[model samples]
Target chain A: MNRYLRQLKEGILDQNPTLVQLLGMCPTLATTTSLENAFGMGMAATAVLICSNVFISLLRKFIPRQVRIAAYIVIVSGFVTAVELLMRAYLYPLYQALGLFIPLIVVNCIILARAEAFASKNKVLPSAMDGLSMGLGFTFALCILGTVRELLGSGSLLGYRVLPESYPDMVVFLLPPGAFLTLGFVIAAVQKLRGMSEERRRRRSAAPADTAAGATAPVAADGAHSAGEADGAGRKED
Target chain B: MNPNQPQPASMPELLTVSPSPHARRGVTTSRLMIDVLIALAPAAVWGVAAFGPRAALVLLLSVASALLAEFLAEKLLRRPVTLRDGSAAVTGLLLGMNLSADVPLYIPVVGAVFAIAVVKQLFGGIGRNVMNPALAARVFLMLAWTGGMTRFSAPFAYLSSGVDAVASATPLASLKGGMLPDASLADLFLGRCAGCIGEVSVLLLLAGGVYLLVRRVISWQIPVSFLGTVALLTFVFPQGGADRLSFMAASLCSGGLVLGAVFMATDYVTSPVTGAGRLIYGCGCGLLVVFIRYFGGYPEGVSFAILIMNALVWYLDMLTRPRVYGKTRGRRGDRKGGGQA
Candidate 1:
């Protein structure tokens, strides 16, 4: 259970394939023009991630090392096709909005990176958990980007006008440059927050060691002083 | 102990040490920035005079947003705040001049912030930015708010309307339909017709450019080559056959050509540093302007032209590299004595 939890944390925060490792950016940049599109894309990619990971893990022992990559792509594509079809039937508008990105998900790097890095080497249960956590992380990042883009680009959230009527929409936010600008700032902000927390942790770990060194210095000084005093006494007796 | 005493001669009060070249000149970044601002002031004044108080408002908002963005970005990025250098002020002023006076208040603010924050500071600030900040912001605004940006008004139309205004086409729009605008050449030259706040007065902008030239604030390469290329192109192919001289004159004065060539294109950070490279960059800008004016969707192509050239500045510099010293003694394959880099 502990190992599973660690793997979950590692996938979501430590090794987030979207934010940290920065894989599968084509959909992350292209499909994140609005929240609905982003949510749909994220969920679809996550589904594929989970299924492919589980399938690859189950077949790891039987799969040959040399031809494993070709086999893994075959499995990943199958899952991607299934997600694409399901969305096409029920969520047609989002599927249309996402357009070429849905079909292109078969080539998304995150699924392949995971299949190679984790599932091929790990057990079925841990591989599935890894897939779940990574999918959640990607969804989280995409949702954030999408929300910002939709809110600023159209001054609405989930097709609802949350901002006042007077708010002027910056159409750039819905465009390609806006994607890069939002992603860059988002990454910079996350790095800054992470840096601050890591600094606090370092200082907390170092504080006691510093005080212990402070306590030892005086004792060492006292021992030197006593040794000098004994030498002085010996000199006086002589 | 020696509170009233000065440092002894053996111990200097200040010590200075740095690498070679040892020559000193009074020219600093701040001084150059101030000079550029001084050169820009006449054009800004003309914009306000022509477009009324609304133009002044846009200019103020642009300058303020730029300064605010610079101060905030510096603080956030934890770099030493160099707002005192007046670079942000220049950028803001340029952006304001490029805008239609009738745009909503938010346009200048957004454009200014985008200019300073994204184009200038985000790309490592100051000399490191790849594109001209003011021009990039203009393009960004143009793309995002095409309707708002292009809703230019007739000259002094705002004097009657107060706030709510109607759309009136300028000379560039008339040229789009392959006809010269109804305004006389003198009106265009004096800038008594409708246009962007800063770009209407070819006379004042040229005067400012001359002042910059006289003060040595910028070199002659970019302005000369850029304007010359544009003039040559339009003269060779007169649009609408409204007499060759008038068409050439109209083409030169109608758009942001003078303002962009003199001010924005000559931005020291984004323009090429080499003498030959500056010429090439300028010519490229001019060609793009003429092409866009002739065939592209928009009437004004100055901002887009300069931006496209700005991207290729590094390659321009590479193509125009000066021969390194002592390289004439060319050695071969480490077989000869002289070291080859």
Candidate 2:
């Protein structure tokens, strides 16, 4: 259970395929013009990710090592076709919204990356878990980009008007350049947050050792208390 | 000047140690930026007089926001604040000039912020930015709100009916339709027309350009080659079946061609450093302007043309590199004995 939770955390935050690893940029930039389209694309890609992962793990032994990449593509395309048809039958609106991207999911590096890196070596249950977590990570990133684009681009959220009627819509946010701009800023913010957290962790780990060093330094300095104060200041600067 | 002759202890306080090439000059970034601001003053004043108080408001807001954004960005980035240099002021003023005076109050503010923060500072500020910050912001705003950016009120309409006046068509729009604008050649030359705030007055912009040229603040290669190319193309082609001379004059005088050629394209940081490269860059801009104006969706193409050429500046510089003395024509990579030098 603990191992599964750690894997989930790693997928969503530490090694996010879209934000951190930066895979599948084509659909992330293209279909994220609105929340509904982004969500639909995310869910569809996630579904394909899971199916392909499990099936690839099952066929791992049978597939020759030399031809594994070709075999992975064939498996991924098959699962993508299944997801596309299933969405067409039940989620027609979403199906129409994410037109070319549905078929293009077979080329998404995240699914293939997991299959090659994890699923091929892992058991079925673990492979399924990896797929579920990575897919959710992709979905989370898409939804974030989508909400920002839709809210600013259309002055609404999830097809509902949140801003007042008089609010001037920044139409650029709906365009291609806006997608690149939004993604760049989002990545910058994520990196900054990660850096801050890592800094805090480092400081916490170093605190006791630092105090012990300071205590020893003052004792070695004998009665010169100002020397310890100066040493502390130097350390602070460092 | 001998190092052994040093006497006073205060000398160390005055002199600083540095690398070779010990020559010194009084020229500074702030001085050059201030010179640009001085050169642009006449056109800005003419724009305000021709348009009205609202035009003044746009210029004021743009300059203020640019300064504020620059200050905030530098502070946030933990760099030494360089607001006194006046580059941001120039960017703000140029951005204001590029915009129609009739744009909403927030438009200039937004554009100024984007120009300073994103285009200017984020790319390592001042000399390091790849594109002209004002031109990039203008394009961004134009793409964002096509309707708002295109709407132009007739000159002095604000004096009569105020800011809510109907959008008067610009000469570029008329030329785009393959017909001459209603304004006489004299009116267009003298700045009695509907257009962007600073761009309506060709005479004033030229005056500013001439001032920059006289001060040796800018080289003549860019503006000369740029304007010469546009003049040659439009004269030979003669859009709208209008008389060649008049059409050529109108095309040169109308739109942001003069404004862009004089001020924006000649921007020091974005244009090529080599003289030959500047000429090619200018001609490229001129060709693109005519091409896009003739064929593109937008009626005016000055900003887009200049921007597209701006992106190619590094390549142009490399292509036009001067030969090193006693070396072959090709680059170091192509020569076997190049590394020894």
> Can you tell me which runs of candidate 1 are displaced by over 4 Å?
A212-238, B1-15, B159-166, B236-246, B328-341
Give the per-residue lDDT of model 2 (tens digit) for B279-331. Answer: 99999999999999899998999999999999999999889887766767675
Which candidate gets the maximum TM-score versus the true structure? Answer: 2
What TM-score against the true fold does each predicted structure earn? 0.87, 0.90
lDDT per residue (tens digit) for residues A18-49 in model 2: 98898989999999999989989988889888
Model 1 docking grade: incorrect
Question: Model 2's lDDT to the true fold?
Answer: 0.87
Where does candidate 1 chain B have its weakest 10-residue lDDT segment?
Answer: B328-337
Which is the leading candidate under lDDT? Answer: 2
Q: Return the DockQ of model 2.
A: 0.29
Error of 1 at B259 (Å): 0.7
